[model samples]
Target chain A: MTLLHTIYLIAITAEAMSGAIMGMRRGMDLFGICMLGTVTALGGGTARDILLGHYPVGWIANPEYLSFTIGAAIVTAMIARHMHHLRQIFLLVDGLGLVAFTVIGCGVGLEMEAHPSIVVLAGVITGIFGGLLRDILCNQVPLVMQRELYATVALFTGVFYVGMLWLEVNSSLATLLALGSGFLFRVLAMTFGWKLPDFQGKEIRGLD
Target chain B: MTLLHTIYLIAITAEAMSGAIMGMRRGMDLFGICMLGTVTALGGGTARDILLGHYPVGWIANPEYLSFTIGAAIVTAMIARHMHHLRQIFLLVDGLGLVAFTVIGCGVGLEMEAHPSIVVLAGVITGIFGGLLRDILCNQVPLVMQRELYATVALFTGVFYVGMLWLEVNSSLATLLALGSGFLFRVLAMTFGWKLPDFQGKEIRGLD
Candidate 1:
């Protein structure tokens, strides 16, 4: 429990920093950068809670999380010059954060007694939607929608956790298993360039 | 009430057509086109309901509305070739839809008896977010944030509605006043190229 909490905080911080990089890339103002970072850090959970009608929204209930993201964004902006050199480490943390989010989301769904399918969907939503929302707000192609096994990794984590719980596995053991497998899968996908086939359904052409 | 319902359907249809055009511009597949249309048509209401913790989300409780968006998208695709000539008509319809959505959203906020500020935010969310979500999905800069008086119109409608209610105005009368004012303002803005000044706050630059 302690480990997961720690990882979740680290994950949000890593995601916020990534958001800051995106903000700098776009030459956004400080407020814009912080806004993007906060959204990136909290978007997925917000989506999940809203979908489940979970009230008070996480950050709204816990201002500290919001503050953490804002502080992280500012710090990232300050250290923007050195970001290039930190990419590798940053990516690793991001991978861990992705796994942490998946596990946490899965837990939330399970707590709600949602159907297995809904639980899996919830996990994937929490794990990936933050980055997707961030990308959308930044006016960039959402990375998850187009490339990599990102959401797939979260799906795997969710499925495994659900299976473990169904088998009456120890709760902590199930969490660790789900987290480890998802984190490793994403890391491997990143290292080996794994990708889901792109959706290339042709769009209709305009008359003009 | 019947008028509002009729206008709501038309609003979704118009918004759906706009979504289809955006999808065509992006070269999306049938499924992608439908997804964009549905989100663009209903995104605002979903955001408003979710933010307020309104249960069941509107579309989930009303599958007919979802079907309407899907049907509209398919129809739009079929008539894509004629869209160039229909732009003006579509723009007018879109303006009307914008007003309809704002009025409906403001009504929702009033029903909830939310704080005046939150009610205004709710109305704006319901009117503007659908288009914003569509723009984000299409990987374009959201038009509302930078240019035009798009969100401003929604804001005006919300404020106007609130003022009317504060003065003990009849609910239906308040709706008409807000809808008329917002629709006219938007049409004028579109015709006259009226715009809010751009935000050009400085962005931090990287060393390298």
Candidate 2:
């Protein structure tokens, strides 16, 4: 398997585990946990494919991905209490997955011959929308919309990768550089508690 | 426009108004209100088309729908407080829209030659997912998943419509019959405060 493909598999597994944890916290049943985990791991790609008119969406074409996500979710659900100690490791893996997802999404957008702007957007969508969907299902405001530089990392990775290709950089090298830089960016942002600005007075009424 | 098409226009407008009101209540800004309204109006079809791998989604294919939704949202945002008096009318139109959306979705599924079950599912998805998505964006458990017989109405409409087609009923007649019956079912359900059964104890912990 290609390096990116390997990372993709690992990332999905991590994403699924995290999603399962969230579902468990919500006291969801087994079916709900599995469904939420699958959506969290694959919803971004599904959304991207649908928007770009890319048919036979990734998981549909490769059903094995479902196995990975569902299996990871079940495993997580069974051992979640013991897994609390792995929080640091989970965060690291999740961050890596975020960046990797961004690069892979950029690859798909490029293959579709989308405009550079759209290509970058596809990447961001693929990177963050899974979590967005998960949060939606959990009945909570999406953290990406209100929290740290999560989406910003995806946006940066996408733009950086697209820019490198535009500059005639080798594709493999560009992917590696983008993933590396983006992961580092995410790590630093988390370590430093970086956050986007929020509306100062959240009660700015009237426009509603 | 055909009868179904005309109803769709009115339905989307009504749906958008309802969505805008929800966003306004959430203290969302003008842009958020418009977006929420649009998503609430169009999200179901967008979701159905994506799942079925149908290209050029409804809104993408006919950008005019966006104008209808956005225009309705903007108007709603401006006069929302006064809209409380129109609750009964709004619910009536929303119910009609729900049934129309189901029939319309079944038509697309039939066009694609999906299995009857999948066709019915598509109809249900197209009928309810808009509201599901709206509730998600507003950060709440989807009422369709928790409350009255809303999704059941879509399910009933789809099955009724598909069964008529199977019996070789004329298409227009089937559409009218399905719409009429589904709308009636919804109205009666509402008038009588019918609801789906919820789990006896919402605190069924441990599956987590």
Judged by lDDT, which candidate is best?
2
Task: Give residue A173's error in model 1 in angstroms.
Answer: 1.8
Write down the TM-score of every candidate.
Answer: 0.61, 0.61
Residue range with the least summed lDDT across 10 consecutive positions in model 1 chain A: A199-208
Residue by residue across B38-111, what tens digits does model 1's lDDT show?
A: 88999999989988878767875665787799899888777776677877777878887887888788778878
Clashing pairs in 1: none
Question: Residue B172 of candidate 1: its Cα lDDT?
Answer: 84
Instruction: Give the lowest summed-lDDT range of ten residues in model 2 chain A.
Output: A199-208
How many residue pairs clash in each candidate at the backbone level?
0, 0
With candidate 1 superimposed using the best TM-score fit, by how many Å does residue A107's alpha carbon deviate from the native? Answer: 2.0
Which candidate number maximizes DockQ?
1
Which ten residues in a row are the worst by lDDT in model 2 chain B? B26-35
Question: Per-residue lDDT of B1-208 in model 2, one digit per residue for the tens?
Answer: 2999999999999999898777777665555566678888999999899889887678756767878998998888667767777888888999999999999999889989999999999999999999998888878778898888899999999999999999999989999999999999999999999998878675777665
Model 2 backbone overlap count: 0
lDDT of 2 at A159: 98
